[model samples]
Each structure stands twice: as C-alpha cells, then as structure tokens.
Target: MTIRAYRDADLGAVIDLWRACDLIRPWNPPAHDIAFCRSSGHGELFVAEAEGRIVGTVMAGHDGHRGWIYYVGVDPARRRDGLGTALMAHAESWLARQGVLKVQLLIRETNTAVAAFYERLGYAVEPRLVMAKRLDRGDGQKNA
Candidate 1:
C-alpha cells in the first residue's frame, strides 16, 4: 500500500472507509470535518491506497503549539497487517516536520480496544478531563 495526501476525489471513499472502520458518528459529520481540514490550511488528511482502493486514513492538524491526530481508520478486512500503525507513524512524521512541540490524539473513553494500540506507540493517558460545551445548536451526540 502507498500512503499519500488526500484529494478531493477521495472524499467519498475516505468517508466510506471511516464507516467501514466504525469511525463515523452522528455528531461529527465526516464531510464537514473533511471540508474544515482542507480549508483551514493547518491540517492535512492522508490516505492509504492498495490495489487501487482507499484502505486507510489519518488526519493531522497543528494548533500552532501542538499537533493533533483524528479520524484514523483502516479497512476492517485489512486490520492486523500494520496499516493502522503505519498511518500513525506517518502522522507523527508529518507533525515533526511542522515543528509541532507535541502530538496528541483523543481516544473515546469506551474504546478500550484501541488503547493498547496507542500505548504500543508510546502514547500514555494524561490525567486530565476533557470538558466541553457545545456551541453549535446542532450538536447532539458529540462524539469528539
């Protein structure tokens, strides 16, 4: 598989991959997220293509001081083949190139299965609560 930056044509496939990997939720619309990243100028979305198919993705962004990763996913049938791990490594490398002081990603509290995946990559859980207040009236099941 080859990893490359996302293109406008890849939007639908990328969103479909996220859904296949159980990454999509009602609150965070994938299309809106993609549009924001592409328009913000500080974010990038990468895709993994194998056999002419989009199979994995990793979205990385920098908030000046730190880099954040989100929307990481891999084809369910393609799991355990190091695709997810490679996507993460790619994201970290991208962040390092941007001079980001730190790299962080939020994992859902109930997502115990992936904790070990991040932990194996040297990510540790920080002792901080992620408090939030929805500013958008449309926010219902805020999955972030």
Candidate 2:
C-alpha cells in the first residue's frame, strides 16, 4: 500500500469509507468532511491506497503549539495490516518537522478498543475534561 497526501479527487472515496465504517456521528453532514480537508492552516488529510483503491485515511493538524489528529479510519477489510500505524507515523513525522511540541487526539469514551489502540501507539489520556461549545451563529446566540 502507498500512503500519500489527499487529492481533491479522493474526497468521494474518503467520504464513502467513513460512512461505511460508521466512523463519524450520523448527524454529521457529509459536507463537514470536505470542509475539514479544505480548512486553512488547521489540518491536512491523507489517504492510504492499495491496488488502486483508497483503504485508509488520517487527518493531522497543528495549532502552533501542538498537533491534533482526527478522523483516522481504515477500511474494514484493510484493518490489522499496519496501515493505521504507518499513517500515524507519517503524521507524527510531519508534525515533528513543523516543530509541534505535542500531539493529541480524543476518542469517544465508549471506544475502549480504540483507546487501547492509541495507548499501544504511545498516547496517554490527559486527566482533564474536554469541553466545547459551538460558535456557529445559531448556537452562539444561546451562549450569549
């Protein structure tokens, strides 16, 4: 398999793969994936291609001081083949080159399996509550 930066043409396949794996919440609109790919100075998307097909994906980003990884997925048939690890290694290398001081990610609290996956990859949970409030116009009004 070959790992490479994402191309605009790969968007359809990437969205399909995420849906197939039930990776993102059902309420999340498909357009969000496109936005993530196009977001400026925030993140980069990558794909793992094998036999002319995209089989895995990852999104890596830096916030000046630290790097954040999100939306990592591998096709079900392609799991346990080291693609995830390879993709992460690529992200880590890129973040290091950019002088990011730390790397972090959040997994659903119910995803014990994935928590173990990250642990094996040398990631440990930070003992702090992660909170967020949407700032979109409709929600911003509620906060105000």
**Local distance difference test values of all predictions, in order:** 0.90, 0.80
Q: How many residue pairs clash in each candidate?
A: 0, 0
Give lDDT tens digits, candidate 1, residues 40-136: 9889999999999999999999998879999999999999899999999999998899898789898876787798999998999888887776678
Residue-level lDDT for 132 in candidate 1:
73
Candidate 2: Cα lDDT at 94: 77
Q: How well is each residue in 1-144 modelled by candidate 2, as lDDT tens digits?
A: 998988878878988898876776754565675576457666788889999899988888887778988778999998888888999998888788878889999777576688877887999988987766666556454321
For every candidate in turn, the CA RMSD to the true structure comes to: 2.0, 2.8
Among the numbered candidates, top TM-score falls to: 1
Q: Compute the lDDT of residue 116 as modeled in candidate 1.
A: 91
Worst 10 residues of 1 by lDDT: 135-144
